[model samples]
Target: MRIRATAAAVSITGVLALSAFAVPAAQAADAASGKAAFSSASADATSGTTTTSTLDVTFSDMKVNNGKNIAVGTTNVVSVPVTYTLTHPADMDTSSDHFASGPLIYRGSSPDTASNMLISDDPATCTATSSTTMSCKGVIYVRPADGDLMNADAGTWNAGALAVDDSGDHTMQGGLGTTKVQRYSKLTANAGPEPVVKGRTITTTGKLTRANWEDNQYHGYTNQPVKLQFRKAGTSTYTTIKTVYSDSYGNVKATATAQYDGYWRLSFAGTTTTPAVNATGDFVDVQ
Candidate 1:
C-alpha cells in the first residue's frame, strides 16, 4: 500500500493529561467520549492479524492537554498532549479511517479507574518526516465525568498507540510507550493583626496540599519545607527571612518580629511529587 500524508489537526474542545496501557476489556469511556468516538478497539482486542507484526510509536514531553499545572478551579478537563513520532514497516495511509488510538489511564502505584480516550482529531495534520517515520502531536481527553487522570504526586503512567489497518479488522498495538507523571500543587497564606508594633512578632500561617485523585480531595501535604519571605512596601523584591515545614496536616506557621511595613508570604519549593507553589501576598502594617 502506498503511504499518503495529509495535514489534518485535531481541534479538541478542551482537556487534562495522563498515561496508557492495554485498554480494559470493556470500553473505558462512553460511545461518543474520548478516542473511543473514533476508536474501534477495546482492552480485549489490541493486537494483530500477524501476531509478530506491530507498529512503532514514540512519545515525548507529554503534559496536561491544556498545557497547565493543576489549580483549584481547573484540573477537571480530561486531556493530555502526546508529542510523538510514528514509525512502521507498513504504510499508514492517512486517507483511511484507520489511524492511531488508545486510552490514557492512571497507572500509578494504585491506578485510578478513570481513563481518557486517545485520538488524532486530524490525521492529515500528522506529518511524514521520513519514509519510515511520521511526526505528530495528538490529544487524549479525560472525558465527560472523568477527573484528574494526571493529578498524581509524581505518579507513574504511560501512553500506548496502535496502527489500525485500512480494513479496521487488524490492530497492531503497543506501537510506543513512555512514562507519564503529574507535578502540580496548591498553597494558601494569611497574616493576622493588620496593624502591629514595629518590635512585636507577627504570626503568619498557611496550608499546603496537592490533589488526591483517588478521592478527588485536597489533603495536607506533610513534612515539606516552606520559605517565608517579606517585601517592604512599594518593592518588587521579596527576601527570604525564614524557613518552615508543613505539619502533619500540611499547615504552616511561623513568627517574625515586625521591623517594617510590608507584605509577607510563604512559598513551598515543592518536591519531585509536587510542583512548587507560592501563597498570595499578605500585606501587613507596622505601627
Candidate 2:
C-alpha cells in the first residue's frame, strides 16, 4: 500500500512507507515491483520484517474509529475512520511528491512484530493548520472475508503512525493509541400462541448469536444476560418485562400474562467482544 499526504497534488507509487515493514508478502511484492497480486494466502499471514528510524516528525491527537469498538460482520468490509495531527519541521514540504504519511492499527507487542495490522487503503487527507502542524483524516478497511481477521483477533489493538521523505528514508512510531475490534451480534425473537385467551400465559423465545470469523458463520453466544421486553399494541414504547440468560445453545425463553395485544422481543446489552442488538419484535394477540 502507498502512503501519501492529503494536501499533496501528486500520488506517488513504488514507495511503501506505510506498508514496507509489516505488509503481507504479496502486497510487499506488489508495492516493491508492481508485478504480484494479493491472494488469500498472503492476506492470512501477518508476519513480516521491521524498519525503524528516528525522524524529526511527530504524530499526536490520534483517534481511531472515533474511539469506539469496531463491529465487524462476516463477508463484509469494515472501514474505520482515523484522525490525527502531524507535526514536523517548518521547512519540510509535506505536499511535495516525494513525501508520504499515514496511520495504522496493529495487534501485538509492536507494529513491526504485530500478529495483525491494518493500514489505510487510501492516502490520508491532511490540511495544514500551521507551517509545521497538520490535521489528517484517513480510513482503514478491514475485510473479514479476506481472512484479514479471526475470532482470536478480537479485542484491543494498538495504533501507530508512519512517514517517508524525499531521501527514501522512512520512520514509524508505535504505541500512539489503541482501539477495540468486536464481532457483530445478532438476535431473534418468536412469540406464541399468536392469539391467546385473556389472563393466559404467553411464551416468548429468542436466540443470541455473533459472527465467528474462523468458520465465517454466526454461532451461539451463551450465558449472557438478555432482556425480555414487551410493547402494547398502538403504543410506541417497549417496557422490559424480565431478564433471561442464554443457554448452552444461546436460547432464551420468557413468559408473561396475556393481558393486551402486544409485541415481544429480546435485547442484548453486549460485551467487550460483541455489540448490542435487538431482535425484531414478534406480535401476539390477546382475545
Task: Indicate the residue-level lDDT of 174 in model 2.
Answer: 66
lDDT of 1 by residue, 203-243 (tens): 99999987765556678989999999999998999999999
The best candidate in terms of lDDT: 2
True lDDT of residue 92, candidate 1? 51
Which parts of model 1 are misplaced by more than 4 Å?
Answer: 1-52, 55-75, 89-92, 101-125, 143-154, 168-180
lDDT of 1 at 128: 72
lDDT of each: 0.51, 0.73
Q: lDDT per residue, candidate 2, 140-196, as tens digits?
A: 888888788878888888887666554445556667788889999999999999899
Model 1: ten consecutive residues of lowest lDDT: 1-10
140, model 1: CA deviation in Å? 2.0
TM-score, candidate number 2? 0.80
